[model samples]
Target: MPWSDHAIWWHVYPLGFLGAEPAALPPDSAPRHRLPVLADWLDHLVGLGCNGLALGPVFASETHGYDTVDHFRVDPRLGTEDDLVRLVEEARSRGVHVLLDGVFNHVGRSFAPFADVVRHGSASSYADWFVPEGDDFRTFEGHGHLVALDHASPAVVDHVTDVMDHWLARGVSGWRLDAAYAVPQAFWRTVSDRVRARHPEAWLCGEVIHGDYTSYVTEGGLDSVTQYELWKAIWSSLNDVNPHELAWSLTRHSALLDVFAPQTFVGNHDVTRIASRLREPRHLAHALTVLFTVGGVPSVYAGDERGRQGVKEERVGGDDAIRPAFPDSPSGLGPEGLDVQRLHQTLIGVRRRHPWLVRARPRPHTVDDTVLAYTLHDPDSGAAVAVALNYGGEAATATVPAAAWEPAAGDATPAAGDGSVSLPPYGWCVATAPTLPS
Candidate 1:
């Protein structure tokens, strides 16, 4: 089967979410067996209406689960392969798909093959597996600890293909290819084709920060790519008080739908928390309104719905703040957290009820520095939903086309005697009209 058209994703950075040590401990250190901790949150995810769990790096690694040391083994810090088996089985039982992070672009300095190259130098049989720069090997973006793999090498290709097959057999629904933009597009086509040959239902999404996303999905054989361009526009536009910026990005976002849907989100493991990034916390609802109502499969970063705050920085240990551990259950949440969680549940309900929003195109009615009004419609069914937002301190009104006007979601209500709606400061609304007969 193809991926569910209405997949609602909940992303978690496992190592950080479970509070694993920042650095890898010695081999003799007792295993933490933290994989089961996530099992405790499966119900929480289901309660939030999420159908997919997008886990960050979880394989054996030197640190942070990114510089992978072994593809076949689960990180000792997390647990044994049995733990992964149990987690996947549990998630599946709850009707949630699990997407593993595939860090194919590089390996930890300690990866056995790379270790052999380090020890034997030119005589190592694996010397050809990595990019050689004079007497040294190339690293991922200058991080000496993250050694880049040579995609040109047949051995590397086979290894990656084997890793993917191994996990898919263990019940992983798909892969979220890490740093995929850094790898050659042809390599992905080869890998994707190989994997799909055996498991045609598998879903493959890439971590593409910048570039033509259309090419990555259509030409590179990926099902989707991270929508970072739209991500940046969401927060930046709100901070700069420029709704037109969001309008332009949405226009581009609509064009991308003509090719394939991108993976959409407001906050993720790699960036600062949305609450911390926005100038005013109230604007959070407006940002989320656009995320869910716009086209694409959407993901909620772990803890974002709880109003978590963290700022990502470039210095050592900078990521620790954003990737903090979560308590094992919902009862642990504070009062404000419970409120945020309720908001997420309600908003996600709106998306789930209108799965066609996945392919709906945005039709803008108004755009200004602090106000935006648009409608998302299913062309084939004539089903439509109107969205209005006001980011300024005072309330604002937006006129909706008579045919598009309908019952609004949240606090928004119809304006008597006018085809318009009123929005409070930092407020937004989602309204749906009856489908016009085709």
Candidate 2:
């Protein structure tokens, strides 16, 4: 879909980024290819300007790959199915973009049709594929091994539309879905209208979190969803210096960018490490400059561009500290993670030179409780950018009504003629302004 308006992603969790064996290997072991260790880091994910990878679960799970237990196999502890078709043909020969991670509303009670309905319970024939309860089934939020499926089963909508048309015909260009708000928004509008009538540029995205993400993307014919409320208002308003709680979630993220671009993130693989949820890790470049100047389809997570910290606690291997383990490549990392991987390759090369900031819509121009300021326009290419943050401790000045501005990427300064920007205490910026009149 217009190549997801230039998707950024780099997410990765492939069984703890290739360390595998957190427990699931024994359906007759011996196939541990470790997904070509992410096809040897696809040129370290295209030198970090992330053209999208976003994986996380590789099916056939019973452990953390979202407990799938075979959506047509492959988690033979992460190998086979020709090592994920040569890691999606070597991440589509370096132009990356993969996405996966489905987990259709629960399965993992040894999911061979819920272990044949726990050894023929309702005289199993996959007994309506789950959700019984008294005779025992409905688990998932209580996590009794996660069973609950049967989203008004039409054989669970032709087995999730033949496992999403057998993995988007084995190439994978999208699909995050996972507990998409406990399924059923008319079963994801009938499996996203039968997987976009045959992979019409796949890209599903759902893991909703809280409700009404624009009626789950117009009644679940979704194309994107997990903006987890601007990822908890950018790390709880920069760990409470509170730029008016990220200016009221960028005014509800500009009303969900008038209805779609929502896949944004800060530190994913289920939270904590934005360099250990910053209390002021120099505002981690003000949360990657409000995640590369707003709008959406952003990703990054894999060891969060190497500022890796990890926390995510709840119990039992608490997401093994935000999904750890990686280092079979990218020249075996660590030199304090290459200055946060060159500050995520300079803010993903300023979000790949502003690919229309993927629907630009922030507009605040100064909100307080420690300096904010915004802009982001692109109404059909009147290209604009202007951002600023600055959880105070001294020097500040973020003006932004955009009369003129330039600097284009952090360590803020631009003050030539009244667009004001000067922020020094925990500073930030993203400049390149001018378009402010409509």
Candidate 3:
């Protein structure tokens, strides 16, 4: 599949974004049909310059969408399968691609096959679909209600592949394989090969938080994996007032670019909102500056562009705060959020204008405890973008290594003659070398 290097994704956790009940509704309860409401935000997302909608789990599950009860059906609380199809069509009409979260590593204890295993014991044909510990089945990350799937089972592979086929047939452009590291690499290779065979343009990214990301994209047959390391560095460095931390992480980021593009973001459904996570709120601009200028496909969590604040803790309902509901339409959003939204728009606009940045890697120009500067240059076209960040109380000065550069984005102003630039307290700037005449 050919990946859209230029894609800017807006990730939404639909279960929370739609204000759906946390627990599964009773069988007799009426369907809420909140999926259609997302259709109303298509224009808002397009206006933000996002061409991709990376939705969190939308499948039928027992509690949260991760505890899948059925891979083939859409959760009734959200809506019918038809609702998703209509939403996909609406998004496509606005020139946006839809990516679905595929949770194949685990299923709810109530999943049909697992329930059958529980009832019929070893006698059940589907018994091998799960791994048993003593008389109990293994669960995902110790969550007993979330039963882990036995990836080696042929039936399991068939069921998952068929689910992909069903959704792709309905217009899903790609799949974000959840808990991909938990499943064996061979299983992903088999499923990815089958999916690509059927839908050649299908993009597959894995939810791999740790381990050699290059191996998963190469041997494991994934196009990309989540860049959690850089995400942590972005917030942590700002909170600690340590730009060297970000510099070290960017060096590692540059190494990974040699392998494949990663799925990058500052906030997501599982983590604390970046606005609250940063010790200094004003650093939000610097954090987003890194997100947009870096070499990867970036995703904006639903409320992040609006500077929403929520802290994700380890207790029950920890994620609820981070994944709050949005109003039905943009008009309902408050006026106070417009500033943050405009910041996101400006940064994303810079990325759209310089699409080559998707492949461009950073070369460090300067690195210090409170200041970091680097240039994202394309060796092929000689195109370069210089980024400078200052996290100090006093204004800092940085010199661009390039012979000459012009301000492309940010609040810092460049000195007229020299390659020097002056950054105000907690300021940043993005500059690009002039292109030669074609």
Candidate 4:
């Protein structure tokens, strides 16, 4: 828990980022020792100011990582279990914490238990491990290749619990439960309670898009959940030139902060890259300004710091564009990529200085179609940072609450004697302020 408070994760989707084969390799094929390749990038990750490496599925799977086959074994495409130990050891040496993706809601058709059910029907010892429909079984979100797990089964619960404990004992810091919204809250509570009894420091974050997030954390006994509402609002509002939407989302975000620190992000592996999502390229900075300044456990999707651009569509290989492989090292990157990296470093520096922003409440001072200004204030400490964003074509200004304000980051000018902060077109700012009076 102490380590997570200072975590700024660099999330990477290993299958795509490491250029592994698109589908499962034959059982007899040679293993690929690619996990250590990620180890080589630790310097780049740490240099980027991120203290956590949040990795996508490294477990054996049928296709993409979400369709998990064997939860206990490291995918041969990623190498053996020993490869993972080395990666964890390397990360530990550099003070980087690793969080693995756990796909518990469903399993690939090839999962041993599911395969047994297919061959032996109800007579299979693993028959109760899945949800059956007549001779067939339930699929996840209509994806036939993905078989939904029967959470009600005690065997299934024990399997998931064991898998979590197995990896936690191996040195990973925590887990990110994939498709957790589809699973029952009580089921998570049962499994989490048992896991926590041993590894209380293991952070459990659910992948919840919508519904009662506060309930998911408290009732489900989870440490956190993804802030998808804010992620969508950040891009949608910027594209529509509607800061009011973002303001509303921020209000909801502050409420969640009362319960737990949601995992906040702009560009992740699932969606189009932030660089491509914004209609006006300059608004990219506006999106990130909200990500780092607002309260949450923030993450920088790999390649986003380099201004990577990729659009996700609803087709077979839509995700490929967003999850492209990286070069061997940071030195191989070009000038343009390095420029964006510098901007991220500047913003992250501001965040590192004001760590309390993880739970600071945003008090809206100005909200309009194209402009938003608010103070991220921690009432307990009387600490605050004023953030102003302008999406209009010309210059814009907004008043912030503070006795005095000095520029912290971004292109906005410093606040004046009257507490007014001004910004050029598509500009933003993060500035520190004197403690506010009660």
Q: Mark the regions of model 3 whose C-alpha exceeds 4 Å error after superposition.
A: 1-3, 435-438
Candidate with maximal lDDT: 4
lDDT to native, each model: 0.87, 0.82, 0.88, 0.90
TM-score rank order? 4, 3, 1, 2
Model 2 TM-score is 0.37
Q: Could you tell me how far off, in angstroms, the CA of residue 89 lies in candidate 2 after the best superposition? A: 39
Task: Tell me the tens digit of each residue's lDDT in model 1 across 185-288.
Answer: 98999899999998788889999999889888777899999999999999999888789999999999999988888899999998999999999888888888
Per-prediction TM-score: 0.96, 0.37, 0.97, 0.98
Question: Tens-digit lDDT track for model 2 on 300-384?
Answer: 8887777888889988988898888887887777577688788779877877877888777887878877898888777775767
Q: What TM-score does structure 3 among the candidates reach? A: 0.97
Candidate 2's displacement at residue 378, Å, is 18
Q: Between 2 and 3, whose lDDT is larger?
A: 3
- What TM-score would you give candidate 4 relative to the actual structure? 0.98
Task: Give candidate 2's root-mean-square deviation (CA, Å).
Answer: 17.6
Candidate 2, position 78, lDDT: 81
Query: Candidate 4 residues 1-438, lDDT tens each?
Result: 367878999999999999999998998899999998998889989998999999999999988889999999899998989999889989999999999999999999999998898899889999899987776788899898889999999999999999999999999999999999999999999999999999989989999999999998899999999999999999999999999999999999999999899999998889999999999988888888899999899999999999999999999998899988887777767676787888899888988988888887799999977789998876666778888999778888877874567788888754566677778888888888667645
Kindly report which residue stretches of model 1 are placed more than 4 angstroms away from their true locations once superposed. Answer: 404-408, 414-418, 436-438
